[model samples]
Target: MSFIASIGQGAINLYHRIRWVVSISTAIVQLAFHPSSWTKPVRAVLTRQIVFTGYDAIGFVAVVALLTGISVVVQAQVWMGRLGQSELLGPLLVTVIVREVGPLLVNFIVIGRSATAMAAELAGMKVRHEVEVLDSQGLDPLVFLVMPRAISMALSVFGLAMLFVVFSFGSGYLCGAFLGTGPGDPGIFARSVVRGVSSYDFYNILAKTLIPGLLTGVIAANEGLSVEGVATDIPQAVTRTVVRATLAVLVVSVIVSVLTYI
Candidate 1:
Protein backbone atom coordinates (compact mmCIF):
# COMPACT_ATOMS: atom_id res chain seq x y z
CA MET A 1 0.00 0.00 0.00
CA SER A 2 2.82 2.42 0.80
CA PHE A 3 4.52 1.65 -2.54
CA ILE A 4 1.24 2.17 -4.33
CA ALA A 5 0.74 5.48 -2.54
CA SER A 6 4.23 6.64 -3.51
CA ILE A 7 3.58 5.74 -7.15
CA GLY A 8 0.28 7.61 -7.03
CA GLN A 9 1.97 10.71 -5.64
CA GLY A 10 4.60 10.63 -8.37
CA ALA A 11 1.89 10.30 -11.01
CA ILE A 12 0.00 13.22 -9.54
CA ASN A 13 3.11 15.39 -9.55
CA LEU A 14 3.83 14.52 -13.15
CA TYR A 15 0.24 15.26 -14.10
CA HIS A 16 0.37 18.70 -12.45
CA ARG A 17 3.64 19.56 -14.23
CA ILE A 18 2.21 18.55 -17.58
CA ARG A 19 -0.94 20.53 -16.95
CA TRP A 20 1.11 23.64 -16.12
CA VAL A 21 3.10 23.31 -19.33
CA VAL A 22 0.04 22.77 -21.48
CA SER A 23 -1.90 25.64 -19.91
CA ILE A 24 0.92 28.14 -20.34
CA SER A 25 1.59 27.00 -23.91
CA THR A 26 -2.09 27.36 -24.73
CA ALA A 27 -2.22 30.84 -23.17
CA ILE A 28 0.77 31.96 -25.29
CA VAL A 29 -0.80 30.66 -28.51
CA GLN A 30 -4.14 32.28 -27.69
CA LEU A 31 -2.50 35.61 -26.97
CA ALA A 32 -0.57 35.42 -30.24
CA PHE A 33 -3.75 35.06 -32.26
CA HIS A 34 -5.76 37.69 -30.35
CA PRO A 35 -4.58 41.13 -31.38
CA SER A 36 -7.16 42.82 -29.22
CA SER A 37 -5.53 41.25 -26.19
CA TRP A 38 -2.56 43.57 -26.67
CA THR A 39 -4.32 46.64 -27.99
CA LYS A 40 -4.12 50.32 -26.92
CA PRO A 41 -4.74 50.26 -23.17
CA VAL A 42 -2.04 47.60 -23.01
CA ARG A 43 0.35 50.26 -24.21
CA ALA A 44 0.21 51.64 -20.68
CA VAL A 45 1.57 48.40 -19.38
CA LEU A 46 4.33 48.44 -21.97
CA THR A 47 5.28 51.97 -21.02
CA ARG A 48 5.32 51.08 -17.35
CA GLN A 49 7.50 48.04 -17.96
CA ILE A 50 9.91 50.14 -20.00
CA VAL A 51 10.15 52.68 -17.23
CA PHE A 52 10.83 50.09 -14.57
CA THR A 53 12.82 47.52 -16.54
CA GLY A 54 14.80 49.82 -18.79
CA TYR A 55 15.04 53.31 -17.36
CA ASP A 56 15.20 52.45 -13.68
CA ALA A 57 17.55 49.54 -14.18
CA ILE A 58 19.90 51.39 -16.48
CA GLY A 59 22.31 52.42 -13.74
CA PHE A 60 23.15 48.88 -12.71
CA VAL A 61 23.50 47.67 -16.28
CA ALA A 62 25.62 50.66 -17.21
CA VAL A 63 28.02 50.16 -14.36
CA VAL A 64 28.41 46.47 -15.06
CA ALA A 65 28.87 47.00 -18.77
CA LEU A 66 31.41 49.77 -18.24
CA LEU A 67 33.51 47.64 -15.92
CA THR A 68 33.25 44.61 -18.17
CA GLY A 69 34.26 46.60 -21.21
CA ILE A 70 37.25 48.10 -19.44
CA SER A 71 38.36 44.70 -18.21
CA VAL A 72 38.01 43.19 -21.68
CA VAL A 73 40.06 46.02 -23.18
CA VAL A 74 42.76 45.84 -20.52
CA GLN A 75 43.14 42.07 -20.79
CA ALA A 76 43.03 42.10 -24.58
CA GLN A 77 45.65 44.85 -24.74
CA VAL A 78 47.99 42.91 -22.45
CA TRP A 79 47.64 39.69 -24.41
CA MET A 80 47.63 41.30 -27.86
CA GLY A 81 50.66 43.42 -26.98
CA ARG A 82 52.56 40.21 -26.40
CA LEU A 83 51.23 38.73 -29.67
CA GLY A 84 51.84 41.94 -31.71
CA GLN A 85 48.22 42.03 -32.94
CA SER A 86 46.92 44.95 -30.84
CA GLU A 87 45.12 46.23 -33.93
CA LEU A 88 42.53 43.51 -33.48
CA LEU A 89 40.86 45.43 -30.61
CA GLY A 90 38.15 46.88 -32.85
CA PRO A 91 36.88 43.54 -34.07
CA LEU A 92 37.22 41.98 -30.63
CA LEU A 93 35.29 44.74 -28.89
CA VAL A 94 32.58 44.62 -31.51
CA THR A 95 32.23 40.87 -31.14
CA VAL A 96 32.06 41.00 -27.35
CA ILE A 97 29.45 43.76 -27.28
CA VAL A 98 27.31 42.38 -30.06
CA ARG A 99 27.55 38.62 -29.62
CA GLU A 100 27.69 38.20 -25.85
CA VAL A 101 27.63 41.08 -23.34
CA GLY A 102 24.67 42.97 -24.79
CA PRO A 103 22.23 40.09 -24.67
CA LEU A 104 23.57 38.73 -21.38
CA LEU A 105 23.44 41.99 -19.43
CA VAL A 106 19.93 42.66 -20.71
CA ASN A 107 18.78 39.21 -19.59
CA PHE A 108 20.30 39.55 -16.14
CA ILE A 109 18.69 42.93 -15.59
CA VAL A 110 15.22 41.86 -16.76
CA ILE A 111 15.23 38.61 -14.85
CA GLY A 112 16.40 40.17 -11.62
CA ARG A 113 14.29 43.32 -11.73
CA SER A 114 11.16 43.06 -13.85
CA ALA A 115 10.50 39.32 -13.90
CA THR A 116 10.63 38.89 -10.13
CA ALA A 117 8.39 41.90 -9.54
CA MET A 118 5.89 40.64 -12.10
CA ALA A 119 5.70 37.23 -10.46
CA ALA A 120 5.27 38.70 -7.01
CA GLU A 121 2.63 41.21 -8.13
CA LEU A 122 0.57 38.59 -9.91
CA ALA A 123 0.89 36.19 -7.04
CA GLY A 124 -0.24 38.87 -4.57
CA MET A 125 -3.27 39.61 -6.75
CA LYS A 126 -4.14 35.94 -6.85
CA VAL A 127 -3.87 35.66 -3.08
CA ARG A 128 -6.15 38.67 -2.64
CA HIS A 129 -8.71 37.09 -4.98
CA GLU A 130 -8.38 40.00 -7.43
CA VAL A 131 -7.86 37.67 -10.34
CA GLU A 132 -10.96 35.77 -9.37
CA VAL A 133 -12.86 39.02 -9.10
CA LEU A 134 -11.83 39.87 -12.66
CA ASP A 135 -12.89 36.42 -13.76
CA SER A 136 -16.23 36.75 -11.98
CA GLN A 137 -16.89 39.89 -13.99
CA GLY A 138 -16.44 37.78 -17.17
CA LEU A 139 -13.10 39.33 -17.97
CA ASP A 140 -10.39 37.11 -19.33
CA PRO A 141 -7.57 37.50 -16.88
CA LEU A 142 -4.97 36.06 -19.26
CA VAL A 143 -5.89 38.50 -22.01
CA PHE A 144 -6.35 41.55 -19.79
CA LEU A 145 -3.38 41.06 -17.51
CA VAL A 146 -0.97 38.37 -18.68
CA MET A 147 -0.79 39.28 -22.35
CA PRO A 148 -0.02 42.94 -21.70
CA ARG A 149 2.78 42.09 -19.31
CA ALA A 150 4.21 39.53 -21.72
CA ILE A 151 4.13 41.88 -24.70
CA SER A 152 5.56 44.71 -22.64
CA MET A 153 8.38 42.57 -21.32
CA ALA A 154 9.33 41.35 -24.78
CA LEU A 155 9.35 44.84 -26.28
CA SER A 156 11.21 46.32 -23.35
CA VAL A 157 13.86 43.62 -23.44
CA PHE A 158 14.53 44.07 -27.14
CA GLY A 159 14.76 47.85 -26.84
CA LEU A 160 16.92 47.72 -23.76
CA ALA A 161 19.25 45.17 -25.36
CA MET A 162 19.87 47.49 -28.26
CA LEU A 163 20.58 50.33 -25.85
CA PHE A 164 22.98 48.13 -23.91
CA VAL A 165 24.94 47.31 -27.06
CA VAL A 166 25.35 50.93 -27.94
CA PHE A 167 26.22 52.01 -24.43
CA SER A 168 28.67 49.19 -23.77
CA PHE A 169 30.46 49.71 -27.06
CA GLY A 170 30.67 53.44 -26.48
CA SER A 171 31.90 52.94 -22.96
CA GLY A 172 34.47 50.41 -24.10
CA TYR A 173 35.66 52.73 -26.80
CA LEU A 174 36.07 55.70 -24.48
CA CYS A 175 37.75 53.68 -21.76
CA GLY A 176 40.09 52.00 -24.21
CA ALA A 177 41.02 55.35 -25.71
CA PHE A 178 41.68 56.81 -22.27
CA LEU A 179 43.86 53.82 -21.42
CA GLY A 180 45.75 54.14 -24.74
CA THR A 181 44.80 50.61 -25.73
CA GLY A 182 42.03 51.37 -28.22
CA PRO A 183 41.91 51.05 -31.98
CA GLY A 184 41.46 54.86 -31.95
CA ASP A 185 39.28 54.81 -34.98
CA PRO A 186 35.54 55.45 -34.66
CA GLY A 187 35.15 54.67 -38.34
CA ILE A 188 36.58 51.21 -37.83
CA PHE A 189 34.30 50.61 -34.88
CA ALA A 190 31.27 51.73 -36.91
CA ARG A 191 32.29 49.57 -39.84
CA SER A 192 32.87 46.56 -37.57
CA VAL A 193 29.43 47.05 -36.01
CA VAL A 194 27.85 47.07 -39.43
CA ARG A 195 29.84 44.20 -40.86
CA GLY A 196 30.37 41.85 -37.89
CA VAL A 197 26.71 41.41 -36.99
CA SER A 198 24.57 39.65 -39.57
CA SER A 199 20.81 39.57 -39.96
CA TYR A 200 20.77 36.13 -38.35
CA ASP A 201 22.56 37.44 -35.28
CA PHE A 202 19.99 40.20 -34.89
CA TYR A 203 17.19 37.68 -35.24
CA ASN A 204 18.86 35.42 -32.68
CA ILE A 205 19.25 38.31 -30.26
CA LEU A 206 15.60 39.26 -30.73
CA ALA A 207 14.50 35.69 -30.15
CA LYS A 208 16.73 35.38 -27.10
CA THR A 209 15.27 38.45 -25.45
CA LEU A 210 11.66 38.06 -26.56
CA ILE A 211 11.19 34.35 -26.00
CA PRO A 212 12.63 34.48 -22.48
CA GLY A 213 10.42 37.44 -21.64
CA LEU A 214 7.37 35.55 -22.85
CA LEU A 215 8.36 32.45 -20.95
CA THR A 216 9.01 34.41 -17.76
CA GLY A 217 5.71 36.30 -18.03
CA VAL A 218 3.65 33.24 -18.83
CA ILE A 219 5.29 31.06 -16.19
CA ALA A 220 4.82 33.70 -13.52
CA ALA A 221 1.18 34.13 -14.46
CA ASN A 222 0.60 30.39 -14.31
CA GLU A 223 2.32 30.16 -10.96
CA GLY A 224 0.08 32.92 -9.66
CA LEU A 225 -2.95 31.11 -10.99
CA SER A 226 -1.85 27.99 -9.15
CA VAL A 227 -1.77 29.73 -5.81
CA GLU A 228 -4.25 28.16 -3.40
CA GLY A 229 -4.93 27.92 0.37
CA VAL A 230 -3.53 30.44 2.85
CA ALA A 231 -1.80 33.81 2.41
CA THR A 232 1.63 32.20 2.76
CA ASP A 233 1.05 30.39 -0.53
CA ILE A 234 1.28 33.69 -2.39
CA PRO A 235 4.92 34.29 -1.51
CA GLN A 236 5.68 30.64 -2.08
CA ALA A 237 4.11 30.87 -5.51
CA VAL A 238 6.18 33.95 -6.31
CA THR A 239 9.41 32.27 -5.23
CA ARG A 240 8.63 29.20 -7.29
CA THR A 241 7.75 31.36 -10.26
CA VAL A 242 11.09 33.20 -10.11
CA VAL A 243 13.13 30.06 -9.75
CA ARG A 244 11.30 28.36 -12.58
CA ALA A 245 11.49 31.40 -14.83
CA THR A 246 15.23 31.87 -14.26
CA LEU A 247 15.90 28.22 -15.00
CA ALA A 248 13.77 28.37 -18.11
CA VAL A 249 15.59 31.46 -19.35
CA LEU A 250 19.02 29.93 -18.76
CA VAL A 251 18.09 26.67 -20.49
CA VAL A 252 16.54 28.46 -23.40
CA SER A 253 19.52 30.80 -23.77
CA VAL A 254 21.92 27.88 -23.96
CA ILE A 255 19.73 26.11 -26.48
CA VAL A 256 19.44 29.25 -28.54
CA SER A 257 23.21 29.76 -28.49
CA VAL A 258 23.87 26.21 -29.59
CA LEU A 259 21.23 26.24 -32.29
CA THR A 260 22.33 29.60 -33.62
CA TYR A 261 26.00 28.66 -33.73
CA ILE A 262 25.94 24.94 -34.41
Candidate 2:
Protein backbone atom coordinates (compact mmCIF):
# COMPACT_ATOMS: atom_id res chain seq x y z
CA MET A 1 0.00 0.00 0.00
CA SER A 2 2.88 2.39 0.77
CA PHE A 3 4.50 1.62 -2.55
CA ILE A 4 1.24 2.14 -4.31
CA ALA A 5 0.75 5.49 -2.58
CA SER A 6 4.26 6.58 -3.54
CA ILE A 7 3.58 5.66 -7.16
CA GLY A 8 0.31 7.56 -7.06
CA GLN A 9 2.06 10.66 -5.75
CA GLY A 10 4.66 10.48 -8.46
CA ALA A 11 1.99 10.22 -11.11
CA ILE A 12 0.17 13.23 -9.69
CA ASN A 13 3.36 15.25 -9.76
CA LEU A 14 4.00 14.29 -13.36
CA TYR A 15 0.45 15.18 -14.29
CA HIS A 16 0.79 18.62 -12.72
CA ARG A 17 4.04 19.29 -14.53
CA ILE A 18 2.46 18.30 -17.83
CA ARG A 19 -0.59 20.45 -17.16
CA TRP A 20 1.60 23.46 -16.33
CA VAL A 21 3.50 23.12 -19.61
CA VAL A 22 0.33 22.75 -21.62
CA SER A 23 -1.32 25.72 -19.92
CA ILE A 24 1.65 27.99 -20.57
CA SER A 25 1.96 26.90 -24.20
CA THR A 26 -1.74 27.38 -24.79
CA ALA A 27 -1.65 30.86 -23.25
CA ILE A 28 1.32 31.82 -25.46
CA VAL A 29 -0.43 30.65 -28.61
CA GLN A 30 -3.63 32.37 -27.64
CA LEU A 31 -1.84 35.59 -26.88
CA ALA A 32 0.00 35.49 -30.21
CA PHE A 33 -3.18 35.03 -32.24
CA HIS A 34 -5.30 37.46 -30.26
CA PRO A 35 -3.58 40.76 -30.68
CA SER A 36 -6.86 42.62 -30.28
CA SER A 37 -6.99 41.47 -26.69
CA TRP A 38 -4.05 43.67 -26.00
CA THR A 39 -5.89 46.81 -27.02
CA LYS A 40 -7.16 49.88 -25.19
CA PRO A 41 -8.53 48.09 -22.17
CA VAL A 42 -5.26 46.26 -21.82
CA ARG A 43 -3.46 49.54 -22.10
CA ALA A 44 -5.42 50.83 -19.13
CA VAL A 45 -4.33 47.87 -17.08
CA LEU A 46 -0.78 48.41 -18.19
CA THR A 47 -0.99 52.01 -17.17
CA ARG A 48 -2.22 51.06 -13.74
CA GLN A 49 0.56 48.55 -13.40
CA ILE A 50 3.10 51.16 -14.37
CA VAL A 51 1.71 53.46 -11.74
CA PHE A 52 1.97 50.81 -9.10
CA THR A 53 5.19 49.17 -10.22
CA GLY A 54 7.09 52.16 -11.56
CA TYR A 55 5.86 55.48 -10.24
CA ASP A 56 5.01 54.34 -6.75
CA ALA A 57 8.34 52.56 -6.43
CA ILE A 58 10.44 55.34 -7.88
CA GLY A 59 11.70 56.54 -4.54
CA PHE A 60 12.91 53.09 -3.56
CA VAL A 61 14.56 52.59 -6.92
CA ALA A 62 16.28 55.94 -6.66
CA VAL A 63 17.59 55.26 -3.20
CA VAL A 64 18.84 51.79 -4.07
CA ALA A 65 20.46 52.98 -7.25
CA LEU A 66 22.11 55.85 -5.48
CA LEU A 67 23.64 53.58 -2.87
CA THR A 68 24.64 50.99 -5.47
CA GLY A 69 26.29 53.59 -7.66
CA ILE A 70 28.10 55.15 -4.76
CA SER A 71 29.39 51.76 -3.63
CA VAL A 72 30.57 50.73 -7.09
CA VAL A 73 32.23 54.06 -7.81
CA VAL A 74 34.05 54.07 -4.50
CA GLN A 75 35.33 50.57 -5.04
CA ALA A 76 36.24 51.26 -8.64
CA GLN A 77 38.02 54.45 -7.61
CA VAL A 78 40.08 52.63 -5.07
CA TRP A 79 41.03 49.87 -7.47
CA MET A 80 41.83 52.27 -10.30
CA GLY A 81 43.84 54.46 -8.02
CA ARG A 82 45.98 51.51 -7.03
CA LEU A 83 46.52 50.53 -10.66
CA GLY A 84 47.10 54.20 -11.71
CA GLN A 85 44.34 53.80 -14.35
CA SER A 86 41.81 56.24 -12.92
CA GLU A 87 40.72 57.19 -16.42
CA LEU A 88 39.10 53.78 -16.81
CA LEU A 89 36.35 54.74 -14.35
CA GLY A 90 33.98 56.10 -16.96
CA PRO A 91 34.07 53.08 -19.22
CA LEU A 92 33.93 50.64 -16.35
CA LEU A 93 30.92 52.35 -14.77
CA VAL A 94 29.06 52.41 -18.06
CA THR A 95 29.77 48.76 -18.76
CA VAL A 96 28.80 47.60 -15.30
CA ILE A 97 25.60 49.64 -15.21
CA VAL A 98 24.44 48.73 -18.71
CA ARG A 99 25.43 45.08 -18.85
CA GLU A 100 24.71 43.80 -15.37
CA VAL A 101 23.57 46.01 -12.51
CA GLY A 102 20.80 47.86 -14.29
CA PRO A 103 18.77 44.85 -15.34
CA LEU A 104 19.39 42.96 -12.13
CA LEU A 105 18.40 45.86 -9.94
CA VAL A 106 15.27 46.66 -11.92
CA ASN A 107 14.25 43.03 -11.82
CA PHE A 108 14.71 42.95 -8.08
CA ILE A 109 12.46 45.94 -7.72
CA VAL A 110 9.79 44.45 -9.97
CA ILE A 111 9.88 41.11 -8.22
CA GLY A 112 9.47 42.76 -4.88
CA ARG A 113 6.75 45.17 -5.87
CA SER A 114 4.85 44.19 -9.03
CA ALA A 115 5.22 40.44 -9.25
CA THR A 116 4.33 39.72 -5.67
CA ALA A 117 1.35 42.04 -5.77
CA MET A 118 0.14 40.45 -8.98
CA ALA A 119 0.36 37.05 -7.39
CA ALA A 120 -1.53 38.14 -4.31
CA GLU A 121 -4.23 39.93 -6.28
CA LEU A 122 -4.76 36.98 -8.58
CA ALA A 123 -4.75 34.58 -5.70
CA GLY A 124 -7.38 36.67 -3.99
CA MET A 125 -9.45 36.70 -7.16
CA LYS A 126 -9.19 32.97 -7.31
CA VAL A 127 -10.20 32.62 -3.72
CA ARG A 128 -13.19 34.88 -4.24
CA HIS A 129 -14.20 33.00 -7.41
CA GLU A 130 -13.87 36.11 -9.57
CA VAL A 131 -11.63 34.38 -12.09
CA GLU A 132 -14.13 31.60 -12.50
CA VAL A 133 -16.95 34.07 -12.87
CA LEU A 134 -15.14 35.77 -15.69
CA ASP A 135 -14.54 32.46 -17.38
CA SER A 136 -18.12 31.44 -16.94
CA GLN A 137 -19.20 34.70 -18.50
CA GLY A 138 -17.19 33.70 -21.61
CA LEU A 139 -14.46 36.25 -20.92
CA ASP A 140 -10.93 35.15 -21.52
CA PRO A 141 -9.28 35.83 -18.19
CA LEU A 142 -5.79 35.68 -19.66
CA VAL A 143 -6.64 38.44 -22.08
CA PHE A 144 -8.79 40.56 -19.82
CA LEU A 145 -6.50 40.15 -16.85
CA VAL A 146 -3.10 38.55 -17.35
CA MET A 147 -1.98 40.08 -20.66
CA PRO A 148 -2.16 43.65 -19.38
CA ARG A 149 -0.12 42.85 -16.35
CA ALA A 150 2.45 41.08 -18.48
CA ILE A 151 2.78 43.96 -20.93
CA SER A 152 2.97 46.44 -18.11
CA MET A 153 5.67 44.49 -16.36
CA ALA A 154 7.77 44.29 -19.50
CA LEU A 155 7.46 47.98 -20.31
CA SER A 156 7.90 49.00 -16.69
CA VAL A 157 11.05 46.96 -16.35
CA PHE A 158 12.51 48.54 -19.46
CA GLY A 159 11.63 52.01 -18.25
CA LEU A 160 12.93 51.41 -14.75
CA ALA A 161 16.16 50.02 -16.10
CA MET A 162 16.73 53.19 -18.07
CA LEU A 163 15.94 55.22 -14.98
CA PHE A 164 18.36 53.14 -12.98
CA VAL A 165 21.13 53.87 -15.46
CA VAL A 166 20.52 57.56 -15.12
CA PHE A 167 20.39 57.51 -11.35
CA SER A 168 23.39 55.23 -11.06
CA PHE A 169 25.56 57.31 -13.40
CA GLY A 170 24.54 60.58 -11.79
CA SER A 171 25.06 59.36 -8.25
CA GLY A 172 28.30 57.63 -9.10
CA TYR A 173 29.66 60.80 -10.72
CA LEU A 174 28.65 62.93 -7.78
CA CYS A 175 30.15 60.53 -5.26
CA GLY A 176 33.37 60.13 -7.19
CA ALA A 177 33.73 63.87 -7.65
CA PHE A 178 33.17 64.41 -3.94
CA LEU A 179 35.88 61.87 -3.25
CA GLY A 180 38.32 63.88 -5.40
CA THR A 181 38.35 61.38 -8.27
CA GLY A 182 39.33 63.23 -11.46
CA PRO A 183 38.05 60.60 -13.86
CA GLY A 184 34.48 60.79 -12.58
CA ASP A 185 33.62 63.21 -15.32
CA PRO A 186 29.99 63.02 -16.43
CA GLY A 187 30.91 63.93 -20.00
CA ILE A 188 33.31 61.03 -20.30
CA PHE A 189 30.80 58.70 -18.69
CA ALA A 190 28.14 59.77 -21.16
CA ARG A 191 30.47 59.23 -24.10
CA SER A 192 31.58 55.84 -22.83
CA VAL A 193 27.93 54.81 -22.37
CA VAL A 194 27.10 55.85 -25.91
CA ARG A 195 30.10 54.00 -27.24
CA GLY A 196 29.84 50.86 -25.09
CA VAL A 197 26.11 50.27 -25.37
CA SER A 198 25.14 49.13 -28.84
CA SER A 199 21.87 48.09 -30.38
CA TYR A 200 22.71 44.54 -29.39
CA ASP A 201 22.91 45.56 -25.76
CA PHE A 202 19.51 47.16 -25.95
CA TYR A 203 18.08 44.05 -27.57
CA ASN A 204 19.59 41.89 -24.88
CA ILE A 205 18.17 44.06 -22.13
CA LEU A 206 14.73 44.07 -23.70
CA ALA A 207 14.78 40.32 -24.09
CA LYS A 208 15.77 39.93 -20.48
CA THR A 209 13.02 42.22 -19.28
CA LEU A 210 10.35 40.78 -21.59
CA ILE A 211 10.91 37.11 -20.90
CA PRO A 212 10.91 37.59 -17.15
CA GLY A 213 7.79 39.70 -17.37
CA LEU A 214 5.95 36.99 -19.24
CA LEU A 215 7.21 34.33 -16.90
CA THR A 216 6.12 36.24 -13.82
CA GLY A 217 2.70 36.92 -15.25
CA VAL A 218 2.11 33.33 -16.29
CA ILE A 219 3.42 31.91 -13.07
CA ALA A 220 1.31 34.21 -10.95
CA ALA A 221 -1.78 33.55 -13.01
CA ASN A 222 -1.23 29.84 -12.85
CA GLU A 223 -0.80 29.92 -9.12
CA GLY A 224 -3.96 31.96 -8.75
CA LEU A 225 -5.88 29.70 -11.08
CA SER A 226 -4.67 26.63 -9.28
CA VAL A 227 -5.84 27.62 -5.84
CA GLU A 228 -8.15 25.11 -4.25
CA GLY A 229 -9.26 23.95 -0.77
CA VAL A 230 -9.06 26.34 2.17
CA ALA A 231 -8.92 30.15 2.24
CA THR A 232 -5.36 29.89 3.48
CA ASP A 233 -4.42 28.41 0.13
CA ILE A 234 -4.53 31.83 -1.48
CA PRO A 235 -1.63 33.22 0.44
CA GLN A 236 0.25 29.98 0.07
CA ALA A 237 -0.22 30.08 -3.68
CA VAL A 238 0.95 33.68 -3.79
CA THR A 239 4.07 32.81 -1.87
CA ARG A 240 4.80 29.90 -4.16
CA THR A 241 4.18 32.02 -7.23
CA VAL A 242 6.60 34.72 -6.10
CA VAL A 243 9.31 32.19 -5.33
CA ARG A 244 8.85 30.37 -8.62
CA ALA A 245 8.65 33.54 -10.63
CA THR A 246 11.79 34.93 -9.06
CA LEU A 247 13.70 31.71 -9.71
CA ALA A 248 12.49 31.56 -13.28
CA VAL A 249 13.57 35.15 -13.89
CA LEU A 250 17.03 34.53 -12.47
CA VAL A 251 17.53 31.35 -14.47
CA VAL A 252 16.33 32.88 -17.73
CA SER A 253 18.41 36.01 -17.19
CA VAL A 254 21.58 33.95 -16.75
CA ILE A 255 20.82 31.78 -19.76
CA VAL A 256 20.13 34.77 -21.98
CA SER A 257 23.25 36.58 -20.79
CA VAL A 258 25.36 33.53 -21.53
CA LEU A 259 23.80 33.07 -24.95
CA THR A 260 24.32 36.73 -25.80
CA TYR A 261 27.98 36.53 -24.84
CA ILE A 262 28.41 33.38 -26.88
Best by lDDT: 2
Please, what are the lDDT tens digits per residue for candidate 2 over residues 1-262? 9999999999999678647745774676478467677677666876898798778888888898899888886687678778987666656766677767888778877887877778778878877888889889766787777777766676788888888888877787788779876355668656755666667687778877767766776777677767774578877877887787778778778887887778
Residue lDDT tens for model 1, 1-262: 9999999999999688757765765676677677776666566766776688668877877777777766775576557667887666555655566666677667767877877788778777877899888889766787767877776677777777777777777776787677777656778656745665667677778877887777777777777777774578777777787787777778777887788777
Candidate 2 ranges beyond 4 A from true positions: 1-35, 182-184
What is the lDDT, from 0 to 100, of the residue 58 in candidate 1?
Answer: 74
Query: What local distance difference test score does each model get?
Result: 0.73, 0.75
Note the residue pairs that clash in candidate 1.
none
Give model 2's TM-score versus the native structure: 0.84
Model 1 segments more than 4 A misplaced: 1-26, 29-33, 39-41, 86-91
The best candidate by TM-score is 2
Which 10-residue window of candidate 1 scores lowest in summed lDDT? Answer: 86-95
RMSD of each: 3.4, 3.5
Worst 10 residues of 2 by lDDT: 21-30
